[model samples]
Target: MPSLPATLLAFLSILSLVFGGKVLVFPLDGSHWVNMKVLIEELHTRGHNVTVLRASNSWYIKKESPFYTSITVYNSGGIEKELFEEFSRNILVIRRQKRSFWTKLKLVSEVGAVFEEMHRNQLNLMGNIFENKDLMDSLQTAKYDLLLTDPAVGGGFFLAYRLGLPLVLNVRWTMHGEAHFEIAPSPLSYIPVPGLELTDKMTFVQRVQNILVYMFSKFQKARTVSKHYRSFCEKYFGSEINYKAILQDADIWLMRNDFTFEFPRPTMPNIVYMGGFQCKPSKPLPDDLEEFVKSSGDHGLIVMSLGTLFTHLPEDITEEIAAAFAGLPQKIIWRHTGPRPVNIGDNTLLVDWLPQNDLLGHAKTKVFITHGGTNGIQEAIYHGVPILGLPLVFDQPDNLSRMKVRGTAKLLDIAELNRTMFLEALKEVLYNPSYKENIQRLSKVHHDQPMKPLDRAMFWIEFVMRNKGASHLRTQSFRMSWIEYHSIDVILTLLMILVLFCVLIYSIVKCICLKVVLKKKVKTQ
Candidate 1:
């Protein structure tokens, strides 16, 4: 028989396997729920205790779902609806406005106000949640092992910092903005800002514009948003914690992007690319969807959506799209909202929602008509579907720009869209074998990994928990100031030395010339 100590040790090991580490996740964007959902579910399946703190009015994050334990942190019922409505209106104005730099800037300023309001509301919501001493005490007693948050919402980082837990950021979009640059090196000379739509190969003027815009955005955020956020942290946490330092101290950054889809840029060792982590093999479609797809026969199918936010398009734009689809032989499956267009096509199927990924994975899915959201693009890429992009706003244009460069997609400005343009773009993507060929080639690269993206993300998450924050993987640059990180001080010191040397050489030359002149005068005399 085994020794009692050895048997006890074996039983403890089994217990450890049965009860994994506890994880707390705060997902910011409702649209981003899909990205975090898979990781959260997988962790729960692997015996980890996962708790998701979600807004009560979230479009996703069902409380009844048994996937994980969900705690409602905020209960602002109408705020989200009002914010989305205002956002939709702003988008309409932007789409109708003349395309000019000033016009775009003006629209962005107007939209900025809406976002500012949303931020303030979110802060208030967070404040309400934190003020509940009972809930706070309960959470504190639970003693979570780590915190995974989407920092885009602005409150998650502060909460994580307050809890004194290992922080892991889930950036569901491509890394950009001030917080992203503070941790990773994003050179303005090449890597485009998320909304700017510029590619890696920027012209001289483009580079200058990019740098100016980047600087202006950082300055604006510091001036306007930073103070409010700082005050919130101080008010709730009862300490003046430097949020930037907290961000830098983060254990891991799980980005929803791949280098194949994005421009090459410097990434820290702790930054892991978990792109397509939510993607999976197509499940059997719902009966109606399966029948609708089968109705296409050999004509093939096109799937169109503007994702969760922009599904309610303007009437004229909707009419234009419907008309365009009406002319096409291929059957159309559009996920749309609002009143149906006047000219609804016979071949088109309009539903409030559809299983997008499953439809994309279908054999008949020839092309994806999308707003170029990262998740949607990743899904299309995973299924090897060519894209006809109608880029709406923020990062959509940039995503499509990359796809256009890759020859896997074509872009159309939603502001300038017409039936003819839409039809031409759609036909080109459908008829051109190059788009399909390119996407297929890239899909192989996307799938050619040692482990699946979800597995990789889970491994890193567990690794952080096991090692208590993977501090060794953190880059030394995170501790450096911006000037020091860029070596500006070194460059300035070298320039000063070079200038001093030049001045000394000039003084020596002047003395030599004068002495030579005096000698010549004496010799002549």
Candidate 2:
């Protein structure tokens, strides 16, 4: 005996479930496929239609899933692949060199140029794909409800703008980029920029260095990347849109970081922390791997992986790592891609890949040696395993630096790594009960949230759709320029006022002194 209104509301709810939204996702890096897969699958299970536009080399789209649609974009002129190859070569050079900080900075500047070239190629590919009449017709017919993209990839933002869809930025790393400042308050005073490897508890000198670095990064972005991105939009979209302003228009920011691990900073309501979303229930180890772990007995185990990109290490470095592992009593499982090292001992097992999360979850696991990729670090944190980090490049140094400060990890410079140094660091982490205790405490904090990270991400995504872009959540600062946002103009005005007041007081005092002198002279006469 329900009322007509109640019956109609129930019907509408059913209708909404039946006809869920269509979401288009543009992932930046190939490694991001693993992370995006989790969110994409969840959205699919919830009756939402999901489509991913991915590169051909993307390992995430192995076989088509029944849950979502996939479209592969070609490399076009092989430029993207070439740029990646050049980048890998440069990394090898940097890894082998024993250079000063300034020398390393110069090397990285060259690498940044490579990145710019790669970005241009990606933009060209995106432009060609979006401009295709057939693809455009099909996309328009599908009528996607929202666009989810990695802000690191400028092309995705341009595509979203062209399609006239609400945009959600999904950053797959803990490190927020320049675009983040436009949406949230990321003060350089305390929050160190990623890649600097500086901690939040910085000395006065370090703060000054941090400020200079931040300004330099801003200048670099403006001088190089932003202009190209703006040009791309104008050329393709036929509109002159401010690139940074487009970032502010984003509906939500799905950042892959937890506050527990990061420095405390101001975050906007629209930014959601979906860290550890990729940390799934550990799958059963393969038969041989399980047997290997069982054979290790009381000595425990050590798992080493330098992530997808850093899989191939130099032979000398590999031999050093092998020598360290050989000295350890624990069984070692190393993920490596290059030729087998000559020094790998009987205690070590080498493989093309390891079930990283599953191996970390093993009870026998003692410590994780990693490249300090955000995914690997988060996974290690989730499993309560201590880390010995060989941070290679980009945010790896910074990520490991934070972990070291938190007492859960130790970091070593890859350029200076030797067998003795590696072994000493490993022994310290493995023997120290404090590292285990600290990591366990952090793991608890990470897992103690009310809702799971994936569920939280899903809720916010649906919330954005429900509210139609969630414009109310945006801050007024989003529309402000850098000077206005930081209130530099206001500070300057106050300084000028103070100067004028001081001048006025000095003039008044001087006039009073002249009058006293004149009165004294008159009395003498």
Candidate 3:
């Protein structure tokens, strides 16, 4: 039987593979990109069809996330974990900021942009959702086993839900309590109280952090903030919209953050920890750049990059930055998008963009001065280089502040702070062996994780496909009541009990009054 009909058997095997195999890998890229494209490139090698359907039409990501950019993955576990621990150590900073009325007003004014991003998914957020949906439609021409997407856009998750396919939401930053709301006694989603900052406790500040992260990473609030988005999606799909489809359709959710950084995993499954997904030492830099960095010699080289987005710094900030670097003996390589200062000093070099990961990986590099992007932080850790985080806005300050507390980086408020103070901070990092030592320790912890995050994520994706879309991994919380999910029902029950007790007391008083009236009448008669 086996010898007969060789063509028939060959056809049957091929048919089986076609009917049940093949994965449509979707790397839904967008503007203001990170190393996600690099992840997509690597994952495509697994004999799966890969399509990068997300558009980076925006100025920010288009320039940063080129299809041909070189990428390297670092395995620095020690420094990463150490940095996270350092963040835990400084819980009191964001915690005890007991604001006066005036201070609260000022704080609100300072953080106004952040608050706006939170409640309303304004700016380019609407455009992003539409683009993501278009990409899914294009990909849907063929069936996909699962969708691997960042949690920001959320359209991919909706696609998976509609197609009845398994999906994974890669968490780019900490997004706490977005899943539930009736926060009683705690903001944490069940993480133990003691390990709040380090591993488990949400506390109020962390909860706020969670909100900030989600808002800044492309606003997801389509109803109020993005009525245009809701209407557009409705027009296109002809259905009631899913406000939280981003977190809901995820059969598996991969967090780019780790337990070392935030509260520990609390009752969430099909969740994989791959926080340092982009943390790694990449390929070597060009010889010229290496030689330039090496030429700094005894003074050492300082990398001053404003990262991709905020490179368009104000002239005031630029002049201050130049003045500050002028004081330091160390040579500064500022990642600038504007004109270099007239009569540029011998010790400073300004470039529109430098190969960041490559420079960080180099030995000649002394310290990193960056805008506190997560990818940059991971790269610095991988290289075991200390940082001087000059965070501008968004999650930059928070990320940098975490690093600063970890003893790897010192924060400098470059916007308003003068040049003298900036120079002093740089000097401290340059002369500080403690910063280097701490970073080295953290580097080890960051890499010492149980498994390579990317591989783990790839395995889950494959597992879902092989299991014919393991939808069971998705949580029932997707359909659960806000009261049940947030546990507000319990609070309501307590309120009801209190009300009953009050009613019982009132009834007892009324009964006593009636009795008194009856007794008085009888005595008089």
Candidate 4:
């Protein structure tokens, strides 16, 4: 006969399987996949069955994994590597130009066009999926407990709605703008919008500028991105279905940020902050890397990386950076993939990739040189490392601006970068003790939470699965019209009523006064 403990263990395993939920993940590729994979691995560990929907030409998402089964859809042309590369090249060239009103206007227009094309491609893919009867039937028959996705792309929102599944978002942004602006109450008077690079406490002029930028972004979004999704919704769904409203109706938002990194702002109950969820303590470095770190001795190390997309700068810029690194006392580990710079320093070690989070956590690490991606910024904060930021494009400058305001980072304009400027900026971050103290304070606050960010995210995901939906947590404000939500209609109605009451009182008094005046005149005669 089998041992009692062995039999009990087997029975418990089966029970866990019975209770496990099915999660259908519609994910964005590239760095977004990096964090989504972390969440998928944790869900797998907890006995959930995860199925990922990926594009046929995906850059980062793998076809097979033990954690989840992937469903590859035929992607025509949307969010490909070449597209981003071209965009990056264009942005760099524009940024290198002298700053002017035209330069800024051109940059904004380029960004709007690029995002519009990306979203259009995503919508086309979703349309194909909907048109394919066999695929649609299989997806429907799977009986998934809920759909989890990153709202940076809109396909997930459409898919969840079509399947009638509770939607959960792995989000810092949506198709229109920041997730909070779409779902939560954002007062622009305090909550600075993205791209403006303003802090919470702004001067009167800055606040006025903030409102203007917010309005401009809305206008740009309406002109460029909204029409495509509007048509897509009308074709598949009824004309009455509002795509933006669907985003607001999502069951849970696993926001990839928290107050430690973000300025304090009004937020919603369903928007759960999971910043640094993917960050963990350092592990032992590979043998060669460890040997290099040991060679640095007491001077510590400077780690440099420009996120996933832009691996290297232009040749001259790279040479300038390499020359600057040569002058530093600290050993350097830089993630560079370009042709070796002739001015490359003996103290610098160049690699195609590095263990980013693990390296940031190392005790010998003194400063981080980054492109200011959210993931990299959070990891730096988690490790209490100060930053020398070279913000390239998109939200990089904005994100670095926040870090600069917090006194834990210094931002350098890549457009005006030279060896001397780069060297001075690096020295400033390294020699400054206040930068270290400020980042460590943030790290302490980030670590002092009741539960780890990953765990909190898991609880909400499972909670949605157990209940089939988190409707109670979701506010119905999305269903309200713009005029109703802002109470503009109510205010106008109250003003009209007051006006009518005043008119009536004035007419009655005038009639009584005239009658009394006529009677007095007749008696005198």
Q: Which candidate comes out best when scored by TM-score? A: 4
Better of 1 and 2 by TM-score: 1
Model 1, 257: alpha-carbon shift in Å?
0.5
Query: Per-residue lDDT of 1-525 in model 2, one digit per residue for the tens?
Result: 999999998887677668788899887665766787788888887779899887666544653778778877765552444466567667867866786887568666875676576567677778778768887778778888888887665677777777888888777431125345656677778888766778777888989999988888778767767777778767765565666667677888888887767878788888889888889768889999999998889989999998877787878888998988888788999998889898888889999999999999999999999989888999988999999998777677778888999999988887788999999999999999999999999999999999999999998888877666877777778677779978999999999999999999999999999999999999999
- Model 4 lowest lDDT segment of ten: 75-84
Q: What's the residue-level lDDT of 56 in candidate 4?
A: 90
Cand. 2 TM to true fold:
0.88
**lDDT tens digits by residue: candidate 3, 410-497:** 8865434667777788889989799999998888887887787778877776677778655666667657776897779998999999
Sorted by TM-score (best first), the order is: 4, 1, 2, 3
Query: Among all windows of ten consecutive residues in candidate 1, which has the lowest summed lDDT?
Result: 172-181
Give Cα distance to truth, residue 183, candidate 2, Å. 2.2
Residues 1-525, candidate 4: write the lDDT tens digits. 989999998888788688899999999887889989999999998789999998898888999999999988898787678879888889889888877879888899888888898899889889988998999999999999999999886889899999999999999988888888997889889999898889999999999999999999999888998999999999999899988888788999999999998899888899899999999999999999999998999999999999887898899999999999999889999999999999998999999999999999999999999999999999999999999998877888889999999999998888799999999988989998999999999899999999999999999999999998899998888788889998999999999999999999999999999999999999999
User: How accurate locally, in lDDT, is each candidate?
Assistant: 0.82, 0.81, 0.58, 0.92
Clashes of each: 0, 0, 26, 0
Candidate with more favorable, higher TM-score: 1 or 4: 4
Tell me how far candidate 2 lies from the true structure as C-alpha RMSD in angstroms: 4.8
Which candidate model has the greater lDDT, 1 or 4?
A: 4
Q: Residues 122-216, candidate 1, lDDT per residue (tens digit)?
A: 67767876888888788899999999987765677767777778888888432225245767777888877656778889999999888888887
